[model samples]
Target: MRKVAEGVYRVPARAANTYLVEASKGLVLVDSGLPGSENGILKAIAKLGKEPSDLKLVLLTHRHLDHIGSAAALKKQTGAKLASHPFEKPYAAGTLVISAPRAWSLYGRMVRKLTTLEYWSLKLFRIIKFQTTHVDLAADEESVLDGVGLDGSVVWTPGHTKGSVTLFLNQPSVAIVGDLLRARRGRLVEPLLMESISQTEASVKRVLDLDPEIICPGHGKPLPASKVKIEKRIVKPVVVAKKKEEEEDLEELTSGLF
Candidate 1:
């Protein structure tokens, strides 16, 4: 585990990164990594001189398999309250399964296809499978870290997923964005896959407007927010109707899954 901020530690569990926030009451974990990652996370807590039971909450930014894989095991082991956006509740609760996201850009499209292929390949070989979990708190725009003894707020930053969110820390001015943006060769860039490019741009602007000193992403190393050049290259013109149609299609595709 590496410390990204005052009380924030980043733990690279497996496929995705998981964060541990030191709260007044206990530890608040942000995004449990891939399946079978509970051991590493629990060890991270122990490294901080805390116990498994000291975990107070598990905050999931979205319902992606990589991000939510270990959620169920961790919750069962630590008995921490699991929290995620309302739209992600069913998938996180194992009631619904999510399909691969849609993408507009060529790179994003390729990434999506590769991701879908990898998931099915792993399943076909019986190498891995997604383990569904449950969400205890339906976090939204109004949700604040104060309820969990932390000084921060949950901001809805959809596009990568309809339920995507960024955790903004008040004291250190850090934004723990889950796939809202990623670091590539020391520069902040958008994720490789997104449900809507328009919503992604809007969400990126919202986080930039916050003027966070540091931005911690779900996949890469934390970087200074100053590295982000929102106006120069991030913003682009996208058809609103097309984006809406994509969103509807994504919902339809995932909804059809049992």
Candidate 2:
């Protein structure tokens, strides 16, 4: 884990990233990495001169496997409260089935094709699934995390998922974005695994509105917010009504247990 700001540390856990926020009372972890990632988190915390029990809260940006997998274990180990948007609470509780939105672009299609194989294998063999845990619900608004020892708030930035959110730190003007965007070839790229392109665009605009100086994505290196130019390269939503044939083809191609 490396400190990106005064009190924020970023740790890469496998393909995902986890962040630690040193607050007045204790540490607040953002996105508990993958399952079996507690060891790494502990090591990272140790580097900060802290321990697992120092974690007072684990805030999830969304309820994807890679984000929420280690949540249960972390909570159990640290006795920290778990918080997330109400829409994502069910997913974290293991009460809702997890599925990705269908891809429409060639790049999206190809990436999905490669990722779905791993997803299918995990599902088919029941290799890994998030453990059921109690979660406290937080509103999709700013200042939600104020009294929780962190110097930031969680903003609703839905796009990658309905309950996706971004953590905005006041002092450093940094945003801990959990897959709402990513770094592609050193440039900021909005996530392709999206439920709605329009909503994703809106969320990106919301993040931009904060004028964050540093962006810590869930799956890639931290990017300077200035490098994330969304206006010129925005991806327009596909007009489904005008592409019935293409829709049919996509459905046929992705109909299986993807």
Candidate 3:
């Protein structure tokens, strides 16, 4: 776990990252990470000199398997209320169907490039370990998280998922964006999978409007807000140079170039 702000700690739960906010009432957990991460979460909390019961709420950015993997288990253990966007509530409640994204962008092409054997191995793991839980609270709009000490609000930045949200903090101008943007090499790109391309583009503009200084992404290291380029479409690669080496670097940094 690492502290990204005054009272915010980013905890890594395997591939996904969750946040712990030291609020007035207690600790507010932003995301729950993957399944079977309960042990790590508790250990991290204890390391921070906090107890499991200190957690008051679990806010999910969206209803994806990796992001909400430990929601049910953590809520049960900590007795915390689960919160999500209204549209995402059904997904958290296990009533919505999730389909793999269409292979249209560079990221999608890279995902499709995986060997069949490797792909199936990963699919099998998620199928066996994935679990869904109920959401007790819902955010109606870009409202402040009442009761939490931190001056934070949920921005409805949909596109990566229809119900995606970005949590913004006033003090540090930080944004906890769950899969809205991803770090590949050192630059930001559209997240690996997306539900609606148009909505995702519009959401990027909304995020820029907030002018966050620091971005804590769901899958990569915390990056400066300036590293992102909203004008660069996910399907097109931004070639930085004509030299062979520089071109190679771009290819390595981005998933697929066509």
Alpha carbon lDDT of each predicted model: 0.81, 0.78, 0.75
Candidate with maximal lDDT: 1
The C-alpha local distance difference test score for the whole of candidate 1 amounts to 0.81
TM-score of each: 0.85, 0.88, 0.82
Better of 1 and 2 by TM-score: 2
Candidate 2 residues lying further than 4 Å off, grouped into runs, are: 117-125, 139-144, 231-237, 240-246, 249-258
Q: Which ten residues in a row have the lowest lDDT in candidate 3?
A: 236-245
Between 1 and 3, whose lDDT is larger? Answer: 1
Candidate numbers, best TM-score first, in rank order: 2, 1, 3
Candidate 3 lDDT tens digits, 1-258: 999888888999956998887887888887887678878888888988989999888889987766787888999899988888888888767687554543344446467355222353358446656566889887544333775565778889888888988888887788888888877788776776667666777887788788988888888778888888654444343222114334555878885655
List candidate 3 stretches off by more than 4 Å.
110-127, 141-144, 234-258
* Top TM-score prediction, candidate number: 2
Residue 197 CA displacement from its true place in model 1, Å = 1.1
Could you tell me how far off, in angstroms, the CA of residue 3 lies in candidate 1 after the best superposition? 0.9
